[model samples]
Structure formats: C-alpha cells, structure tokens
Target: MNIYRHEMRMSLRSMLYWTTGMLVGLLFFMMMFAAVSEEASVINLIVSQFPSEVVRALGLSTLDLSTVLGYYGYVFMFILLVASVYALKIGISALSEEIRAKTADFLLSKPVSRNVIVTAKALSVITLLALQSAIYSLGAFIIVDIITGQPYDKTVFLLINLSIFLVGLFFAGLGLLLSVSIKKIKSVLPVALGIVFGFAILQMLNQSLADPVLAYLTPFAYFDIARIINARAYESAYVISDAVLIVSFTLLTYIIYRRKDIPSV
Candidate 1:
C-alpha cells in the first residue's frame, strides 16, 4: 500500500498532463466538427481525390466526416496514438526508473518482496490509466453534446471510447514485459516511442493492405471503429485477442521480475 501510494504520488503530475492534453485535443477536434459538418461534402470531395489506399490508411475511407461520430472516429486515431504512448511510457518506466536512478538497491533493501513492489507499481499505472480514460470519456460526451446538439448513440459512443482504455491496457502490459525482459534500459522514452510507432506503422499497413494477418501484429488494429459504429459492438475475436495479450504479457512480466537480478548500486 505504501508503494502504491508513493508510485501514484510520483505519477500524479504526469497523469494530469496526459489527461489535460487529451481533453484539450478532444475539445479542439469537436469544435472543428461544427465547421466540418457544414462543409462535409466539400471536404469529402477533396478527400476523394486522394488515393484510395491513402484514404484507407488514414481511416477516412469508409467514415463520413459530416457527422459528429464520424469526425470523432477520425480524431480518435490521434487520441489512440497519444494514449498508447502514455501507457507504454508508464509500463516501461514503472520498474526501470528504479534501476535507472540507482534506487533499486534502496527499494529491494526494504522488507517487502519484489512481487509486492511490482504489483503495487503495476496497480498504480492501471489506476492512473483508468482515471484518465474515465475523464476523457466524460469530456468526450460533453463536447459532442455541445457541438452536435444531437444525441449520439450512447452504446456506440461508449464502446468507441472504451477501445482507448483497452488498447492502453494491452500496450501497458507489453511495456511491462519489455521493461523486465531487457538487460538494461538507459532511457525508456526512445524505446517506448519506437515500439508504439512501430506498431502504429504496422496498423497503417494493415489498413492499406487489408491484410488479415497484419491485424494480428498490432493492438491498434484490434478495434475497428467502422465496425464498432456499424455493428454497435466490438468484434469478438479482437476482444479475445486483447484479453489474451494482456494476460500473457502480465504473467510474463511477473515471472521475469520475480527472479531477475537487480544490479547493486
């Protein structure tokens, strides 16, 4: 409990920064929706001129930019990217920071077991992410209501927003696994950004190539916004994949962390 509290306190500023950035970005996108709604057809025409592959890669091929939900879907790509980065950073740095700062010796010297320490840090990251997702959802609802002045499908809206959280979880687990698996990490940001963008680029390839196999390579491809909006639910296969990924990586992280050697300070 003490470790959890300390981790949360250390992470509070970062949590606020990410939440504020997401909220501000969502508000800015929603504000633009009004103008875009008016000129949707014109914008669509302009978009149509772009290559079909490019349109699909950008997640604009099948979506209608005229509607609030459609605009939200497009803006969601950016939101997901940012959210994934946050999750990955949290996961990568959760334990690595102790080692990087040469505080692992101090932390391990305590009476608590390493398992407890890892659990507490992991919980702190998950709690912070859940809070951010909840706040972002509320802000999205309020912004959409104000901008569109029409009630969107609540079910679809929730599912769409929920994907952000789920993707964050998957990446968080992956990040944790990597943090423990690696021998030494001098800097986490570069590695985290590389992994996040690498997966993102894979997703773009999946979109452009329309390959089923590539979808399995990236968590971002798991939740298709178009399918969610149309079917009003997430695809079962991807949901199961997400569950498996999170569980597998989390277990692996615990296993490795429990036995892994910590360098003497």
Candidate 2:
C-alpha cells in the first residue's frame, strides 16, 4: 500500500505538466468537431477539410462520424492517439528514467522487492491513463451534445469508452515492460511509434489482402468503432483477446524486471 501510494504521488507529480499540455492540445481537435456540427452536411464538411491521404492515414475512411458510434469513434480515436503521446512519454521513462536519474539505486535500497516496485509503478500509470481518458471522452461527449443538440445513448457511450480505455492500458503495460528492459530513452519513442503504426498498417493491409482471418493479428483492426456503433454491442473477442495479451505481457514484464540487474551509467 505504501509503495502504491508513493508511486502514484511520483507519477502524478511527474506528469502534471504533461497532462495539462495534452488536455489543451486535445481541445484544439474538439473545436474542429464543434465547428462542423453547425453545417447541414456535417460529415462531409469535416471530411472535406482533410486531404485524402491524411484521412486514410488516420483511419478516417473506416469511420463515419455522423452517427453516435461513428462520431464517438472518430472523436475517440483522435483523442486516444493524442493522449498516447503522453503515455509513451511517461512509459518510456518509468524505469529508464529512474536508472538514468540514479534514483533507482536509492529506490531499490528500500525494503520493498522489485516486483512490488514495478507493480506500484504499473498501477500508477494505469490510474493516470484512466483519469485522462475519462476527462477527454466525457468532455468530448458534452461538447458534441451541446453543438449538435442531440444526446447519445449513455450506455453505448460508456461501453465504447471503456473498451478504448482497456486498449490504452494494454499499451501502457507494453510501455512499462519496455522501460524495464531498455535503458536508453532515445530509442524507445521510435520503437513505440513503430509498433503503433505497424499495427495500424497491418489493419489497412487486411483490406486489400481480403483476409478476415488476418484481421485478428492486429489489435487496431479489432474492436472497430463502425461495427460496434452500428450493432450497439461490444466486440467480445476483441475485449477478451486484448485483456489476455496485456495481462500476459504485464506478467512477463514483472518477471523479467524482478530478475534483471540494473546497470550503472
């Protein structure tokens, strides 16, 4: 309990500045939606502003933002990707920063074991993620409603947001695991970006490959917003698989971090 509290304090303190910045940045994108809502052809107006390639790259083609699911999905993805930037910033530093700052020596000198330390840090990261996602999603929802004069199904909104939140935690685990394994922060960002983009690209490839089976290979491909929104149900397979994979990876990270030796700079 003490370890968890300490880690939470440290993480919140370290992330206070970054979280504010992300919220402000996200507000810019939300404003775009608010502006377009006034137009009769709201969807087309929003789509027309972006280049075809830009739209395709961002997965906008797969979404139709006029419907609640589509709009929520579109808005959700925008906010998620922007918020991920902050997550990666923190995740890359979770372990490496401690080592680099020479704080690990002092921290590890404590009575708590490595597993406890890692667990606490992991929990702290997850908490911050949940807080950020809720703020952004809820804010977006209210803004959408205010501008459009229509309310979304509260149940569906929460369900979809929860799914997105789970996916964020999965990546958080991945980030923390990487932080423990890799000492250098410089390379972590590129690798993380690569992993994210790679998943997205693979999802796009599934379209031309015409391989429904291959769709399961990419996390981004699963839990699609359009399908979920139209059907008004969660994708059980995606939720299950994502949970399993993230939990497995987190466990693997804890084991490795416990046994690994910290190197001196």
Best by TM-score: 1
Misplaced by over 4 Å in model 1 are none
Cα lDDT tens digits, model 1, 1-265, are 9999999999989988997898899888888887898999999899899999998888888788887778889898889889999999999999889999998998898999978988999899899889888988998888888878976788999999988889999999998999999999888878878999999999888999999988988999999888889999888998999999999998999899999899876
What are the per-residue Cα lDDT tens digits for candidate 2 across 57-172? 56667666555455556766655554555676566666677787878888888898988887777777788887766765676566556655666777667766665467677677
Best by lDDT: 1
- Model 1 lDDT on a 0 to 1 scale: 0.89
The parts of candidate 2 lying over 4 Å away from their true place are 13-27, 30-62, 187-191, 207-210
TM-score of candidate 2 versus the correct structure, residues matched by position? 0.80
Model 2 superposed RMSD (Cα): 3.7
Locate the minimum summed-lDDT window of 10 residues in model 2: 31-40
